[model samples]
Target: MFDYLGGNFPTIDRRSKKQMKDVEMVAQLLLFLEEGVRAYSQEYLDKAFSDRDISWDAKEEVEKEFCNTVKAIKEILDLSQDINLSKTRLKNQADFYSLFGAIAELNRENEKLTITRDIGVRINNFLKLVGDTELKNQSKDSLTDYQRNALEYYEAVKFSFTDAGTRKTRIRIMKSVIRGNIN
Candidate 1:
């Protein structure tokens, strides 16, 4: 649904029929990555909280999970362009809604993101909890199944995903999530 540049679709300079097909394949692969980004965000949040050795919402730690599938696709496709426009090859981004990538969007300027709707509400009753820091020193918080999966996937990626191909890693993680086999 999205690419890197403006957080929109990828633009392709008509290269070859083969290149076009490859781009199409990359597009399909990236489509599944939206959830991967979400899972990564969840893992990031959980790790940040756990490593703190205390319960506190650090707004600075909150960040929207985003993917640079465009670059990955470019690398995968081995795309390049000469200094002159004569050799141009790839272009993307007719439009993009950057906020769509955020787990929670407070407004046009708010940068607070959440792992999930339930966690966001638990952290704060407000629609926007990012950077609010009202979180108390609570003991073990209940995590959703998605959150658990995200955490498990994080550990899996840490070990098995090391030195793997980026595109393959993304697809593998997505498949694990779909199969509920992240453990």
Candidate 2:
């Protein structure tokens, strides 16, 4: 938060509602990045053939959607003087925290999706080894049903681990900024 001028001294305006709104929007963007795009890609991959290649064009489309959503949410954070920070409109730090609650929910979902993909990879590897005489002979009960099923499930699913934990931490840090505890 920056204040343009106050004599020779630069001023911090952390308590301003506008800044908090920006932080909230950033948090939402992070959540979406961590969850939404991954889910979309998974849905697409699940329907496609196991050996099929996901085109760069399709990847670009998902990226573009993410970018567009961020840009749209940024309007809430633009901090224009005309925008009102009324109490009813998430105009404070607590409201921002509430927004993070939503973010955490999304983060949880994203983690689940990641676990799905990891299990899929393990399953595929195990399937490959099944045909190898030496590997099959070494272990009959090595892979659990859960692990075996995960590979089979891979045919219908994909997952992405969008790294948004850093952003979540930043959102929490933004609180101290609101309270004038950070420079």
Candidate 3:
């Protein structure tokens, strides 16, 4: 992760366990943002498609709602201050994890009104396109360029979440994998 930062830095000792845990917390925040984007985007798409004719007002409204929700999520995970100070909000790691679990449950309950299953199918199709022959045969440099363009298009036109909704779906799948829940 630090390699992605792109700067010369002095060598440091290996991270402590606490530092690793902090990194995990940051990872969770990233996951939440990713799912939040998907959920909000899907909400916008659903509104756009609900009527036979797409209304500019409806599209703007959806965009407004999505922006607001994303702002709220960012506030909840604010990293502007020292992370050690922020960790005081949750008494322990267990509490922190449980908070995400509760949030996932709440997100799941709220997703019944949306067409997540259909969206999931669309997302699957987009993934298949990304992995098709052209992508598979490309040189690494060309593949990187192609993937960036393709993914941008995919996100703009085809991104979606599984039946469980974005946030809850990721949580559920992670739990399932951890628990050996595969069929």
Model number with the top TM-score? 3
Pitting candidate 1 against candidate 3, the one with the higher lDDT is 3
lDDT of 1 by residue, 1-183 (tens): 223333122444446434554344343333323223322233544464465447534322332222332332332233222222111111211111111221212221244321233321221221121112232222226644444434433343344432224324333433333223432
lDDT tens per residue, model 3, 1-183: 223211211112256334554444433433343434233344444453454154444445444443443332233334323332222322233323323443343444564222223322332333355446565455656545435443433333223332224334344432332223321
Per-model TM values vs. the true structure = 0.19, 0.20, 0.22
TM-score of 2: 0.20
Off by over 4 Å in 2: 1-57, 79-183
Question: Which of the predicted structures, 1 or 2, would earn the higher TM-score when compared with the native?
Answer: 2
Model 3 lowest lDDT segment of ten: 4-13
Candidate 1 matches the true fold with a TM-score of 0.19
The residue pairs in collision within model 3 are: none
Better of 1 and 2 by lDDT: 2
Which has the better TM-score: candidate 1, or candidate 3? 3
